[model samples]
Target: MQNKTRYFIILLILVPVCFSADILLGSTHIPFSIFVDMLRGIEIDETWRIIITELRLPRAIVAVFVGIALPISGLLMQTFFRNPLADPYVLGISTGASLGVALFSLGGGLGMVAIISNFGFASSWGLIIAACLGALMVMLLVVTIAPKVYDTTSLLIIGIMLGSVTSAVVSVLQFFSNPNELHAFLMWTFGSFSGLGWTEIIIMACFIVPLLIISFTMQKPLNALLLGENYAQGLGVRISLLRFQIIIVASLLAGVVTAFTGPIGFIGIAVPHIARMVFKTTNHKTLIAASILIGCNLLLLCDMISQLPGFQSSLPINTVTAMFGAPIVIFVILKGRKSRLHYS
Candidate 1:
């Protein structure tokens, strides 16, 4: 409890600092004094004001929410599956979004883009809508199949197979795609927070905030689930209803973020482990909160790094996250193995 309290305090301080750094330390350097002045309602240079308000601020806000949504979704997956390796993408949600983008980008002259554009989302919004539909399709399939399978391991394997099939389809699309279209799709895969504007951020928040509230309300049931479904049911938890809610929440959290930001890997898998290692508890009440903070801080840090000081161009957010996240996952796997051997 004391450790959890300390972690919370540390996160309270660090998250804001990270967010401020994200706003101030982008490719275009804005001095702290200038930012402070802007905050105080003083007129600033037009370029700097636009840069701060239009670009960096929205990017940082997206980073914060993406961080919160992905990690919490991952934590729920890991707990629900009772597998250390389960993540938001483990069930092919990201692949579904990718497929949607692929269809839009590579389906040249297919009139899909034209059809979507006719509805007034010809820009990034169209891509986002397509991605959401793809993700929803996969989630619906998983939810439909989940009831038939008594064990989570089977469901886990099914998700992997679905992802593999989706990837194959995407590969086929890529092979036939025009170079310019392929490039566009590839760039989207790189993942970015900067592309989101205030309107997009508001839409993302509408999905994320309500889902987060729903997730928080399931804390007791989630904790019960960590022990196994049988054990959770023994505690009077309704396993089927709980499972349904978790899948829905996790799917929306991951699917919406992927739709907006492209597919961000590793954060979902790694951030939860980081929180667990720090707080040393499986209690969803604590883990969920800790994951939210740790996830936000980590992504903000990644966003700062990707900005590449002194350069006008930024690195892909996915690249920065994977570089950090992959090693952490390896460490977790090895540690888990070692602990299992020791116990045996």
Candidate 2:
């Protein structure tokens, strides 16, 4: 318990430091003193204030939220499926979102850009709505199939199949799309923490914050679920209803973030496992808190690395995350296999 408390305190301190570093590590570095002044609302150089408030601020805020949303959604999916490999990306939720964006941005032709220019509201909301619908469709499909599958392995296969199908469809769309639209879609696929403004941030908060609060209320049931469905039912938990709510919340969290920020990979699959490994507990309560803190810090660190000093152009957010997260995933698979072999 003393060790856990110490780790939590360390993580809490790391969050703000990471956040400030993310904001400060761009092309034009903002001095730490000026950053503090901007926070205090004391007037400084106008250029510095604009950089701090208008540009770096929103990116940092979105990075924090994406960090939080993906890990929690991953945790819920991992628990719900009882599969370490399950995540928004693995389960095809992110691809579903990418499909939505492709259909809206690629299939619709150059006229869609005109729509975005003419109607400022449709610029972001169109993609959000499209992505939500696509994600919901995939979630509904998965839920419909869940009862029929007897094992987690079969379900994981189905998820990979779903992702492949979506990718094929997106490839077709890309082939038919014009250069401008194709370029736009390609860049979005790279993923970004920038481009979202305060309004989009508020929209994301409206969906994510409430759902997260509701997830906390289910920790007791989630803990019971760790024992198995029959055991959870014996403990008076409503299995079907609980399953539905978890699916909806996880789907929406992944969909909304993907809609706004493109489909970020690996963070979802990697972070929850990191939380469990660090705390050495299966308890949802501790895992949830640990995932939030660790998720935020890890993603902020990724964001900073993506925009390293002296680089005029930043690396894609996905590139950096994959570099870190893919190795964690590989280690997990090997460890799981070794454990199974030992038990056998």
lDDT of 2 by residue, 1-344 (tens): 58889899999999999999999889888899988887887889999877877878898888889988999999988887788888877678889988888888787663443333234322467766777777777877877876688665677788789988988988988887888777877878898988777898899899889988988998999999887778999999998888877877888888889888888999998999899888888899998889989999998999999889888888999999999899998988898897842111
Off by over 4 Å in 2: 109-123, 147-155, 341-344
Off by over 4 Å in 1: 109-123, 341-344
Least accurate stretch of 10 residues (summed lDDT) in model 2? 113-122
Give the candidate number with the greatest TM-score. Answer: 1
What lDDT, from 0 to 1, does candidate 2 have?
A: 0.84
Which pairs clash in model 1?
Answer: none
Q: Write the per-residue lDDT of candidate 1 for residues 203-320, one digit (tens) a residue.
A: 9999999999999999999988877899999999999999999999999999999998889999999999998889888888999999999999999999999997898899989999
* Total clashes for model 2: 0
